[model samples]
Target: MTEYSAFKVELTEHVVHVQIDRPEKANAMDAAFWSEIVDIFQWIDDTDAIRAVVISGAGKHFSAGIDLALLASVASQLGQDVGRNARQLRRTILRMQASFNAVDQCRKPVLAAIHGQCIGGAIDLVAACDMRYCSSDAQFSIKEIDMGMAADVGTLQRLPRIVGDGVLRELAYTGRRVQADEALRIGLVNRVYADPEALLVEVLDIARQIAAKSPIAVAGTKAMLSYMRDHRIDDGLDYIATWNAAMLQSEDLRIAMAAHLGKQRPTFRD
Candidate 1:
């Protein structure tokens, strides 16, 4: 995998840990930062060694939305030629959106371990993850309103699916910060730890647990769940049935059945 200045990537067993490295900037998203995120996930997809992933920030905060300097630079560039700049801006935004989309598309489950502030684009990142855990000090907000725009990224769409339309509306419209307790109550975070260190330990433990499962089964289940989320019930049923048809023929199932019959733990290939 390529070395990234804005992020760090480490692989252990079957879990990939990705940390935002720009602590001085509160891990803010800039063009290079988003590019690196997309690259790392693509690397994960290419490498069979990684079966699950955990994401977090390096500093006190998870992220502080878009970098103010990047935003200013784009705004200044837009003044040069409105029409051309508008198209360029749209393309750039879409590229950044693809970074988060990679998390959703990854075959392995992606878990977010958030701390401090997770606002705007940070919310987009977490929303794309398969599950979220956070520190008790973590706070989240759909901060696009504060930036004078509706969130154009995945947050507006994905967050509603996670927290319901009413809750999403209240938060997005107001841009008010939601503490970890409130996030947990609304199902935004699955668990909250006392602090960042504890949060890291808990999240990594969860990741390792997930990594121990049969890779084929885990990947198939993740794919099926994602399909079900966007499809009708009948369609989802059909899809799962087709998936199972192929999956049932794998050696893992035979191994699992034999292990069950013998009252022993099943071993699976990574």
Candidate 2:
């Protein structure tokens, strides 16, 4: 229920809808954005009533990436001393990176509903989500190469896992615009809708489905999947064994089993 300058956050049922609200700026990531995102997701992680999230942008586009003014501010602060500038810039980059890391690390499932232009840092943002869906008009690019810099955020690290090395390398190197169809073909998005309205409707419905599930099971599933991304299969199996040993004791399991046996709907307690 907290108000945010860069976003409009609303909770309905157990799903939280986070919309980037700076339409006049194409929902660009400004100074407020980087800091507010981390706070919002942290709150989502701590709230038991919230079970799922759908993030989308308001207006004509999802996002145009990091605000140019913000980037300019960083450039303007560079000192003549090379060592000091490097140290300052590195710290700044890490801070921005943590903003998206919050989305990646959130225990609740985060689904991105993208439309129109999803460029540069926008790619990095959506790449951190558990799932991505876009409108037919959506176009994505790894725009940092065109801006005379390497993508310093989560894109370079996380996207390769989502879209594979070959496709990611091609996009990163060329900065070519990938249309909605191509994005789906390359696995950048799970599905494409005719328009932003349809896109949000379906994605939010998916989030609702996720919210209806047992929160403990969903969290464990996300944790196991995230863990397996870096660990070996055997390690993942062992980890899950330890995980489920504790999770199995949750009352949710008994409630779910009783509902099944009684042929009735299950209602889980937060």
Candidate 3:
């Protein structure tokens, strides 16, 4: 039970629940957050017992986005050399981007259970998830436009695929809040619940279901899906054919077949 400064993590029945724990500050992404998240998701990736993950906020809001104090600190570190400042800024942005990249690269399925205000960088966070679900009270925004900057993280890149180009452009350009129903309509969220409590209950159940599946099958599916994002259909087919050539021989496949023939629920190893 390792503790974290910006998050609370728990593992139950092969599912990991990762909560942004800074409710008092609306779970703002500070320096600690940017660094700690990469570590947390990496741990999730390496732990075989973690078959699925659910990410959510602790209290009122999912997040208020990047903490202004962190921005101010970065600003304070800037000096008179414009070239040096540019290099430093690029490094900082890339570091922040890697935090979400870790979530995207995790082998386990990552599900976002959002509630309240999921704004700015929080949008980037959930954009990296495999699936998203929210409560009726959830309000999402691509808020960097309101802050006088473009979103430089995963939101601008990953969201176009999730919400489609036109809808993503409207949200990113306008910085308007999309309520839960609209989120569902635009394919941003799979489902919406009456409240956060109900949202977590159902989303966790979904994670449990996914966790019950053969880990090898799930990981291969996720791998192929991620590969297809940048590759052509033919390339993806070739890659998967090569992948399954080795993967199909896994013992879990035999276990799954036996369980199916026996008319019993499959129990897979971690």
For residue 139, model 3's alpha carbon misses the true position, in angstroms, by 0.3
Off by over 4 Å in 3: none
lDDT of 1 at 236: 91
Worst 10 residues of 3 by lDDT: 57-66
Model 3 agreement with the true structure over 167-258: per-residue lDDT tens digits: 99999999999999999999999999999999999999999999999999999999999999999999999999999999999999999999
TM-score of each: 0.96, 0.99, 0.99
As a TM-score, model 2 comes out at 0.99
- RMSD score of candidate 2 (Å): 0.7
lDDT by residue (tens digit), candidate 1, 1-270: 568998989998789999999999899987788788888988998887898999999989999988888888878777577789889999988887888899889999999999999989899999999999999999999999987998987998798889999999999999999999999999999998999999999999999988877889999999998998889999999998998999988998998889999998888987
Q: What is the C-alpha lDDT of each candidate?
A: 0.91, 0.96, 0.95
What does candidate 2's lDDT look like per residue over 1-270, in tens digits? Answer: 799999999999899999999999999999999999999999999999999999999999999999999999999999899999999999999999999999999999999999999999999999999999999999999999999999999999999899999989999999999999999999999999999999999999999988888898999999999998899999999999999999999999999999999999888887
Q: Which residue runs does candidate 2 get wrong by more than 4 Å?
A: none
Q: What TM-score does structure 1 among the candidates reach?
A: 0.96
**What's the CA RMSD of model 1 in angstroms?**
1.3
